[model samples]
Target: MWQWRIVGNGGYTKIQNVASGTFLDLFTGTSMPGIQVQGWARSASESQDWFLRRVSRSDVEIREILARDTHNAANFQGFRQDLLYLVLPKSVRDAIYVKSGLKNMKDRGQLFDSDDYAFFLKVEVAKWGVNTLLADDFGILWGVMFGQKGNHGLAYNFYLNENLDNIMFFDPYTGDEKVDMEYKAYLAVY
Candidate 1:
């Protein structure tokens, strides 16, 4: 599914995929350790190139796939612990983070799902401040849209753990068993 080919002139190489013709791109803007290294539209960005390093007199090191049989590589396509969910596509996710829901129009001036993503996050946050039930209080009603071509695309839902200290959300994009909340962008998943 992947091909490591030689490209450029001065000892440069490019890693491309066979199924989708996209190249391995190391995100354009940021350089954080977990910055997304994804498959983006092939272009002349340095993120699309790789450098071969010589370790010893005879050892040349390149990429490595530690766990290859867990279906992780096939789904995510690459490795970046901080950006593990990038298999979902940053163009579809976001810039600073690969987040879902509506932050496009409200807080974060992002363009990924600007209108819809902002709406979804707004709904989730609003739910916390809203406590109006017909039998209890008063509030306005609202709704969300979900589909491939809707204002809000529903890939997953958010929930809290039993203790409520940390969030336990579900992301169809990330099939993770355990997620560290300290550094990663996505909340912990079941």
Candidate 2:
């Protein structure tokens, strides 16, 4: 289903679709761990170059060697842990930390649904008055004008801000905050 050949002695390889002839590539301005790979025309860019690391006789890991590598190979585990701290809630983080034992900060952000993430944001905004959601994944498609043919171009959240907190939300529907008083005013129970 796929074929590849090394590009001379430059230590780069081009993987091709046997049926389509397109090479595996990282979309420009959007190369990071956990991001999806795409198929594009062959080029001399390093985004298309891959490093093959043989973990065992039968196991090999394909790594993309971009000009600016975000991951630190020497401390990969620590990197993943730090990523968890940036996105996960305190309760979920504590649970994963306890369950993982020596696993450090385990990622459970993907497990949460939209409502769950929204609720977490709601609670955080109420309790700490935080304004933004600091995230680890940079795969969001923003400002995209789809199906416009040459007029439409793709845009991504290649967040290069000093704080790196690109996504911010403010709840407009929620009314005044409620607190427990002497008399229990019970609303509709879920």
Cα displacement (angstroms), candidate 1, residue 170, comes to 50
Instruction: Name the regions of candidate 2 deviating beyond 4 angstroms.
Output: 1-9, 58-190
Maximum-TM-score candidate: 2
In candidate 2, what are the lDDT values of residues 1-190, reduced to their tens digit?
3665445426656677766778788877267987777888887777787775321110011111111233222322211111111223334423422442322323354564323333443343323313343533322111110111134321111111123232112111131111211221111000
Cα RMSD of all models vs. native, in order, equals 19.6, 21.3
Best model number under lDDT: 1
lDDT of candidates 1 onward, in order: 0.35, 0.32
Which residue runs of candidate 1 sit more than 4 Å off their true CA positions? 54-190
Instruction: Write the residue-wise lDDT of candidate 1 on 1-190 in tens digits.
Output: 4565545536777777767777878877456698888887778777777785421110011012212212122322221112111011222222222333232234333444323442454354335324322222222111111222223323233222333222233332332222221222211111
Per-candidate TM-score against the hidden true structure? 0.26, 0.28
